[model samples]
Target: MRFRIAAALLTTAAIGLAGCSTGAQASDPNGPLRVAVSPQPHGEILEFVDEELAERAGLDLEIETFSDYNRPNEALTQGELEANYYQHQPFLDEYRTEKGGEFAWVQPVHLEPLAVYSKEHRSLQDLPQGAKVTLSNDPANRLRGLKLLADNGVLRLKPEVSESARVEEAVAENPKNLELSTLSPDQLPRTVEEADAAIVNGNYALKANLKNPVAIESAEGSPYVNGLVTTPQLKDDPRVVKLAELLRSPEVAEFIRQNYTKETVVPAA
Candidate 1:
């Protein structure tokens, strides 16, 4: 309850937003460990920790909730935040590769499965031919959606296509001839009313309160485990290490299990 929540909004038209300070100096070992996170599960989980566990553990946590996918890592890299906790390995890897930052992946906390959801349709097979299928515009996530469709037999990806292949190049066949459209990840859940089907990230779906996805990606062998990230310099800091440890503890895992369905959020093994 003593922790503060800063809301950062990112419009799809303008991704570059002015940075807001967390008032947490990374150089101060005893100061609050500031972390940037997505609003739904990430922010909620951190809130639970800050309220129920952090004080007892001798940790001070300041949680900032970002609606945008790109800004948390940017804030962390710019020294505006001590750490961040919203992205999975693939997304983080892409950001580090493209931005040339040394953010360390501290620990895997949970997996938010990517799922296919629709308002008018009951299943992926129920989707009509030439139906509009919406997906995330971000490259890594776009590929993830494409793969999810391929895995479900709604489409087929080119065997020769690499992870970095263009979305168009990745698709070898569209049996339903579905028209694919890309939008910001936050916009995906809203597409339920407009698009015939949409591949949505779990947190967004949970935010939108969309229950019963037609198809959800399996947690088994999934590489998209959401975790904590910090600068290499602070990777081994006791506070960072402790936070990571608490995130993966049995108590936190039990909280995730109690609060969300396994298909929506699975604690990382």
Candidate 2:
């Protein structure tokens, strides 16, 4: 009878363990979803989402902030991260083409307009001839800078030059004859003192504490907006869908508006 009681006790303990295991599985189907992001406002933005919504959705969002553009994608592709929120579609396409990786943009999250910042000039019109202008040297960003320049009449591109056109494609008719220099996006903010003007990405500009960039890209209907991206396998996953929805939530939208005012970091509808 004591052996039978011992067996019953063992069975009860096994059932309790199974019940706890089942409860944990129900709470976190796949456990926490790890995300990689660029430092500052992007990372900060994620903090808001992670605290306010992700936790409630059973998503344990672990954010690893990167200082440069290259590592986030590398991390995501290597399966070290489940998703990333630091690049535009054009940039992602170029990265995939060059790196031979398999990843896809899950959804458009925000538009961080590329802007021209200067200590000497209040507007692009104030930029004089021979002004030293710094533009991002990466293929994708070079094109974006060129388009912004074209929009401001600083340079002209062929009529057919679409959003994808790069500096080499410019047909410079009456080009401000401005001296253009190329640098990494991260270097643009530091070089602004020497440069009469610099076309800097929104995040870098914000990092350097430069307020109200002289000229911002008009991203009203532009496709060059930034997005949330993930591995191809996770594209259809319900967790990804939920995360995307949270990104577009009212709370995230308000955070973006308050944090990136005049920088135009619009949340995706």
Candidate 3:
């Protein structure tokens, strides 16, 4: 009877030890960190860092790519992704306010300047009166394009309008009577021939071979700084903190400089 009791106690201790071991492994610091990214430069840039730096930092980065601008945030908020790297602060702020998503910015990663491109006109000055202009239809980018227009002195906005200003909110003064048309961001390049000019995001511009943008957002003092963001729950996670640091590293900066060229996508260091 005593032998059986001793054996049972030994078995229980072994099981307890095994449970502790499993718990420790589950909480390992070097576990994989899942990150969702938008297609093109954002995902491509993350791949570069994942291959070159993440491993060295004892991090295994799992990248999930999405085609739409809205899915990355949705996936992150749903806890399906650890973090995302596809939006600027303004867009993120708007999303959180409008959708009630609980997320926060980890840090600014890169800046993709919104550029006003034209196939017909070389400069804004050449654009004739009542010329049709194509802007992004998305709520976030519409505001960005409006700000870009305001910056170029093409139109004057109300004094109350800020960087978060949208087309509906704009109070045009001496507007040159330009006819503004909003379209999907992807279609901006395609509409260039039909419209006098189009505001194109940098990624789409790069894909469509429209590199030398006639006018680009001034990166020096621009408010549109792209960033890495995660749910508020994971904000304190060490892996998230490490990834944020890796984003601003020398390696990432060098990669951006070599890959993007000509200050189109500047590192937000």
**Which residue segments of model 1 deviate by more than 4 Å?**
8-26
What TM-scores do the predictions have? 0.91, 0.83, 0.85
Top model by TM-score, which number?
1
Better of 1 and 2 by lDDT: 1
- All candidates in order of lDDT, best leading: 1, 3, 2
lDDT of 3: 0.75
lDDT score, residue 266, model 2? 63
Superposed model 3: Cα runs more than 4 Å off: 1-30, 162-168
Model 2, TM vs. native:
0.83
Kindly report the root-mean-square deviation of model 2 from the true structure over all alpha carbons. Answer: 12.2
**CA lDDT of every candidate:** 0.85, 0.74, 0.75
Better structure of 1 and 3 per lDDT: 1
Candidate 3, residue 204: the lDDT equals: 82
| Candidate 2 local lDDT, 72-167, one digit each (tens) | 786666565678888888888888878877887887877777889888889988888878888998878887788788888877777766444555
lDDT of 1 by residue, 15-34 (tens): 44333554334467867888
